[model samples]
Target chain A: MSELELQNKKVAALASTETIDGEIATLNLGPTHPATHGIFQNILQVDGERILSAEQTVGYIHRAFEKLAERRPYNQITPITDRLNYCSSPINNMGWHMTVEKLIGAEMPKRVDYMRVIVMELARIADHLVCNSVIGVDTGALTGFTYMFQEREKIYDIYEEICGARLTTNVGRIGGFDRDFNKEFITKLRAFLKEFPKKFDEFGALLERNRIFMDRTIGAGPITAERALSYSFAGPNLRAAGVDYDVRVMKPYSSYQDFDFTIPVGNDGDTYDRFMVRQQEIRESLKIITQALENMPEGDYHADIPSFYLPPKEEVYSSMEALIYHFKIVMGETPIPAGEVYHSVEGGNGELGYYLVSDGGRTPYRLHFRRPCFIYYQAYPEMITGSLLSDAILTMSSMNVIAGELDA
Target chain B: MSEFANTIKDSLLEKFTKTSYELDGYGEHNFFMSQDEIHPAIEFLKNNGFIYLTDITGSHYPEKEGAEFQVVYHIHNLSENLRIRLKVDLSEKDVHVPSMTDLFAGANWMERETFDFFGIIFEGHPNLTRILNVDDMDYHPMKKEYALEDETRTDKDDTFFGR
Candidate 1:
């Protein structure tokens, strides 16, 4: 046969053969879809309803936070961390500041430690509520979401009362809180503690025993404990797989050792396990917050290091030393020592670790954030391999895959 | 101390000279091996119970002349409850290393991320496309020389001859 005839025959055979067996279909889940709570897109190769392969395409909401932090001063990085995990901004803020503090060897007072624990626990509760509520919403239950969101609003109210901001709360400073928690903030937190349990019980009862919810969650996206640990899954997801590792209980940063709480664990290692683990964690967080509030100390909130933290307004006006310190800190002229430190905090989702390298300049030499969601999201393709598309949504929601943290 | 990390380290030291392996700052059983020994070291680690690869990351240090890229691999042993970190330094000119995804399937995205951020090339990575950035982007933003241009800047029309 001639070369041209051979080429024509080969093209005909290639066109006749199927590229993918049993028909491969592509589905775009969303950069703006309801399934993805935030801006995230997932491209799925579906064989019928089951996902043959899934690829999570993030960076739609990417603000290049790490690059931005490298350019900004050490103190200015807190607000960027605040946006990394918007639902738990205080956790991110405290985690980032604590990493910088560790690099500088900043010693914080006991009162400041207690305050940090309290705020962090509050952020934990707020973060878990959103995760659980969204899981319920994804499973086709809306009432529980509304109830949990109302409780989340109460936590936000406490945050607003403590700091001027609600969501992006730059409430924490380098060595301690930006300011002391006032009587109103304490009173409202006490009220939240008293009222949250009843509402929590309602949320739990609403979803825990519901037959359809249980069917959708149990055994859906079940990852083995070995696989979970291999993926570096931490916080509730790791605990959900029956790994009794909690950064707070294990590492105990920022006086987390002073508070008493249990690390909840789940054995099934499925979407239901993750959901149950987070639900119980909300209760444990409440206990920790209550203890922190009861043992709240009376002393300086911010550290005495006026060069790093802003001095009080009274001190700024009255003392020339404080005024100079204020001017230097505000203008980002403070010299941070050269060193590196890795500080990991047990964020609501998992281990939110910050590894900061400083060249003794005002800005960080390099800042690497080990975001929990990013680690968890890495296992998404495997997690949803044989599950339905709806199971993928449940898995994402159960994993508490925050786009802010994942994309960052 | 876990026997798994020690066993792997001893085995790696046997194949490569002691000068080629240096302990990390933590004094944990972690070590930074020379880049040439990475594939064999990973193979040894996998064959001897370090089955789980936890995380892979790339750190860029521009000051170092040729040794600018530091690739980190975190591995865990389920039976031993131990974690070990293995690091290898790669240069900007040739940032190629053997892919570990064949041993640990979870290393797929982690290696892709290192390649995406540090421009490191994994010899056997299955689908080695840009995982985080657009395919058209020319530079790796995580590198030291990457400039931060203002995204909002636009060119004006004042260059027209009529104006």
Candidate 2:
């Protein structure tokens, strides 16, 4: 037998033994277990309740988004982005849209820019809501999760008012929103903005200072700032490690420079630090949303570019130039600049970046996503290596490794 | 390029003479180096304050002569608010590059995912294996020659949605 096989057999024999001699027990934590919160398996070597080692196996739902983007037209690829980090699909959609805009040099009107900020910030809030409450849930506080998730549904309603879908909201077009935000959207957004904080505060009060929640998270799975940086950590996790690097602040895109918000940092890069950073971030996202809505500019929602945006159908019937442009758009014949560009946004998870290489074709030659979850997940096993088995779930939940994002 | 970005470019040029590179728009440089120079270059840059390995991914150029795969690395210096792009070329027969996992433990799975998709092995990766794809998948799906959908998936007939 091979060494691996021999070792496995020996382990099996030891596991079956009635008279145990302190050999570490093996546990397949998930590919389907509830604790993981996603489709991923962790082979945990444990001694009673303390974890000895954790070997993670992701990609249970590996949809080749990068490869698929190569085949699909630039516009068609927007929907493909929707599947990555599905909790915050709108943010990915906007990020992809902006990346293309950067490639094409499409300048947007101020209104279109701020409108995007509102939608993107809402998506950020929704993502953090799921992550923070799910962290609470992982620590056996299910009631707080139920409370916070209801607020997420309200955010979903706001998304529905703007886009026709909620979950995988292919909400906007390349240059800007497919259509202008209506009065209904503004009303619903105002209601959500007005109402969400109360529920958020109530949810926070439930677990923020709860002794059990604090103990389960505060020092569990701690990582130093230097270690977190070496691991290329970003977003809240890096922020929790006391690094205040936010993409919105560092590399401001879509007029984020006009808005003011603080990047919350935590003392220790532990589960509690991750939790607190996200909680504070939700409040900051709300602030950005309010500012964007209040100072909402009055202009065209979509950029006035004939190349990216198709001419109106009425004009297409009357004008030859319009007809040709419309035809080109329908046939996916838009010309792409031949160059390489890397654009990043402060994704709900971290610095979500898209590195695009174009060959002057309608589609990208190569596209790679700097998926925050994927990068941060590498540090997961190391972080959970010596912690109690129960804390492993908290660390995983705090990392917010969405399977769709992870596998993509 | 900004003066700060140019300073970084000049410093690298002064240190590693005759290294191939391209100027990226964001005031950063994309140094096209050889596989052998990747480790030394990263080590030098790490000492110079580019502490974070922001991302590691592969870009395939099947049509380009001599270079079939390009392993791209984005290294960041948070203190200076500067980022640099490093690309190393690999031909079809030999697609090996030194792993960055030893330098940055966060590179472990990113390198594995790249290997899973592109079959470009990182020589010193501690446990390099297929990530984000089933191990049983024989072919690397992200190669330029590979089609996006499986040819055997017959239930869907030219429909965007499987429905």
Q: Who wins the TM-score comparison?
A: 2
Per-residue alpha-carbon lDDT of model 2 for A34-81, expressed as tens digits? 777889899988767766566788878877788888877788888988
In candidate 2, which residue ranges exceed 4 Å CA deviation?
A: A1-21, A317-319, B25-28, B149-163
Error of 1 at A229 (Å): 1.6
- C-alpha lDDT (0 to 100) for residue A204 of candidate 1: 92
**In model 1, which residue pairs have backbone atoms overlapping below 3 Å?**
none
Per-prediction TM-score: 0.87, 0.93
Residue-by-residue lDDT tens digits, candidate 1, A1-408: 632254346434433453335666889989799767887788987766767666777677777777777778777888899988899999989888788778777888988888888888899999989999999888889999898899999999999987888999998788787778988998899899998899899889998888988988999988888778667788899899998878797668889888878989999789999999998899898898889888878889978787888888899999999999998887677877776556679988888877676788677777778777877787887788667788998888888888888878
lDDT of each: 0.79, 0.86
lDDT by residue for model 1 (B1-163), tens: 4565666667777877631454533343556777777877778777766765656778888889788888877665645656667778888788888887666656777777678777899988877777667878887888877745543557633222110
What i-RMS does every model get? 8.7, 4.3
